[model samples]
Target: MQKMKMIKRGAASVAIALLLLPMADTAHATIVKHYGVDWSKFQGNNGKWGYARDDFSISQIGGYYNGYFIDQSTYGTQVSNTIALNRRAHTYIYAQFSGRNQADQMLDYYLPKVQTPKGSIVMLDVESGNPDTDSVLYALKRVKDAGYTAVLYGYRSFLTSHLDLASIAKQYPLALAEYKDYKVTAEPDYNYFPSFDNVQLFQFTSTYVAGGLDGDVDFTGITENGYKGGNAQAPTTSTPATTTGKQLHQDTHNYTVKSGDTLSAIASRYGMTVNALVTLNGIKNANLIYPGQVLRVADSGQGSTVSQKATTTTTTSTYTIRYGDTLSGIASRYGTSISALASLNGISNPNWIYPGQLLKLSGGSSARTYTVRSGDTLSGIASRLGTSWTALKAKNGLANANLIYPGQTLYY
Candidate 1:
């Protein structure tokens, strides 16, 4: 994080004044964009690490400062909480411009402590200390070499003045910090955007929400992309397709559980629900699975018992909404759409879902017209609608398959 300097008002005074300001009109409220916050030890663990509406959260795990390693006190808690809340959790290392070996030392100490899954982005904060281009590059290279995507973060002036911004931008994504005012800015002003092509995130305000949480808007899909989950692998099982007479049979097989295997991942791999998997294996707790334990992935001969039950059961499958549950997240998990979920559940506002509410998992109406939602791709919608993407594109007269917006209705 860049050092924040105040002029006339103190921290408390500024927060109070901001809170007292009139809220924006409901009609003119900024469209919900990809918002995120970066946290350090200063934020503490009294629970306010980030906004509830945040799309992602980045926490400082540990870093090299002056000649020693400084570990953040709230790194583990923040990372775990972010993951538990189903938001993308990223980590950063504040590196000094001492030498190339400083990057190595920092990674050695912090990599073991990082809780995010492999291939997630790990930012290298290089705003403080004397700027050295070689040192920065060394740190970024080390971060990528350790099997995680690397992003460079620094103030606009610090990055432009002392570093090769063009060359660095070509090599790695940049998170530039250039605030306009002390007040919370909902969006970044592109007029003041730094000269770069691969800029992923812009730190628009240092006081996004009261207690010094920096507000960031992801211009590109850097934070939105990648596997943002626990360090778990799905079970390895072979689905052998054979023909007995005229009917094709998918042979059921067993999978020996490995370390870091999750029941959800295993179930998803074998096309079985978590509950069905648990019932089939007679497991007490879904979370408790050990290495080398053999579990049935599918049923043989007459097909899976879950599949048979699905065909015979007339009751509508449902899910109870939990804390931090979002319509978009739930839809993706169940292979449905936000519009479908909203229409089926009598929800006028997709953003507003309460905990403990029962939501139907299946039996949404097959309407001829479909409204697009955020994160909806053409192929995904086509899949849900039981049609080819090309056919949908031609029928809807869409020029670009990649270009679609929320609330845009398409007729099939």
Candidate 2:
């Protein structure tokens, strides 16, 4: 985790005003929140999820996180991994899809193939090159009509520059991705929060290295079954009845350790004492905590269940600095912090960085099979794999290196 400086971008002023408007009261507590990841083709099975599993209470797996169908052969394998992760970790899992040609195809071609359970989210990943606003809206309508929770994922720039986010923000919850300089900033730029008034999730860092995953700040439990919007509707099965004064229990909520977070700070957030937290989670050394460590913040009654998710051992990778790179420039480019880089590389001074110095980029890469999908290119795969285009082509034995298709297995 890295501290992010919040700088207001152009449209933030108006969005703040919109946020000030009064609305119906909902349950407001630190418990109804979590942090998690959005996966894609580059990542493999849950074992390869690396340090990420330690930091997140929820995960949004993409057969649709990007707009492509996974290779059919491995598609079932991915779904099985998702379910196993959810059950073993007691984590909330949602399904996300990018919108373009695949938006309309989600309810048909994709959903059946993945078999995401009902009541789980089906989010729209809106980024550059997505379809027209009307087309995207219609596609969302189809998702909502299919009995899944519909949500929107886009950055402030993507929404402001590419589409009319205002039109749909009122209709659905917005997951905003807006990154600032994580090395120096302590928190996300509240000033630059998007103008779409219904912001639900804020992705503060794409390069969150604490858990070796993307960092997000979520207000609503989109993964925790707390985002179910009700209407003039019948009572659904197994829905827990709303109870006032339910005992504050560990199973009820959790908090991920963020950059600059201390045990005292987290205890303060949950209205608990430091000793209480330490006792609850069995912390032998309060000062030895690191980023991405999940802390149990609440106490449970006799029936309260405990999570079984354990942190797995992780590996590391190295990246040699290029001539033009500064510590800040490298940190920004790699989604890590200058401090983390310095700590990993054992540099005494953050300012002193040079070419040919190998900095640890992430946890070690695992050998895996990637099934190519529509719109994938060799160059794109190489960038994600941390290898060059020529290396990838040679590894896959491509004569042209320019052409590839869906369902082709390229080993890395």
Candidate 3:
């Protein structure tokens, strides 16, 4: 059972648009305010998907009920159709939580069948069964382990009664279902929002258009976050922008931690060592990171060495978009911004990238050299350069790879 019917509540006297307010900080900047819909087998494979103006879509994959795995027959068709229309597609599991094992079984059965990209969001629809806090948390962790952004979806009453919502909100984003009435087409009134932070999506109506379809509004861009499609190829070169008479240094960027994230994994993803991350962030314990904790991934300061060559030519490279490609994922993999890619490629819609489309990547300076630091290791340097220690040794002609000292110059 999905989106259980509830008695209609009285409409609010004043409709306050809370999400339209300015975000408190830069961490909330990625939130994409777009309308979407959640579909299930009941919706069928009809051509009337009111998706002409929608930006994202979520479809139910399956569930575990009565010790049996129930699959949603329309799951594959709906997901593929949504993607085919150039919409951001995601999947949800209608979890009937009997215990931790049942939760795992539900995910194990349905995760293999998910049709979305690797880092797309996967929601756990928890409206039925007796859901304990541990079982729900375990299921969310399982979803994250499978490489999808895990979101918890439920009505306000069900979530508050069965789980510690405050604790859960700290670790995972929430998709709350609270409607004024059935078949209502208006936007969600923020006055009736649940008493919790990290509420990324609000399910406002059951019947979005002529036919019955659950309509949702994403206040935060949780659906837009993460890699969307295609295999992300590594950039060929590491290019550092230069200024006259000034030495180039590694610029820092912020990464907000998500549920089930470990320091090692974050470090590995950013091509930095654990020790470097710890030193950069002043983290006392590497294993104590929580969701929403913003960590700086690189160093920031003036370098002691001055650049001999101040002028460099701009180099351009091309990437062929594969199946399920997205501008966001391509930009991220190439260390460029979506806006930059769109501007470079003259792409009007970032979500409408197609297979075999060629995208131009423009950046980088001349050949660069790295001066080893006191605490630097050979492998650590190679990771930062997107190369291996063996390559670094070969390029620099070092007899003893382990005997590099401080102030040693290495070319990558």
Candidate maximizing lDDT: 3
How well does candidate 2 match the true structure in TM-score terms?
A: 0.42
- Tell me which residue pairs clash in candidate 1: none
Q: Each candidate: what lDDT?
A: 0.61, 0.50, 0.64
Selected candidate, larger TM-score, 2 vs 3:
3
Ranking by TM-score: 3, 1, 2
Taking all chains together, each candidate's TM-score versus the true structure is 0.48, 0.42, 0.51
Clashes of each: 0, 10, 1
On a 0 to 1 TM-score scale, where does candidate 3 land against the true structure? 0.51
- Model 1 TM-score, all chains together: 0.48
**If ranked by lDDT, best first, what sequence of candidates would result?**
3, 1, 2
Candidate 2 lDDT score at position 332: 34
RMSD of 2: 25.6
**Model 3: how far residue 18 lies from native, Å:** 3.6
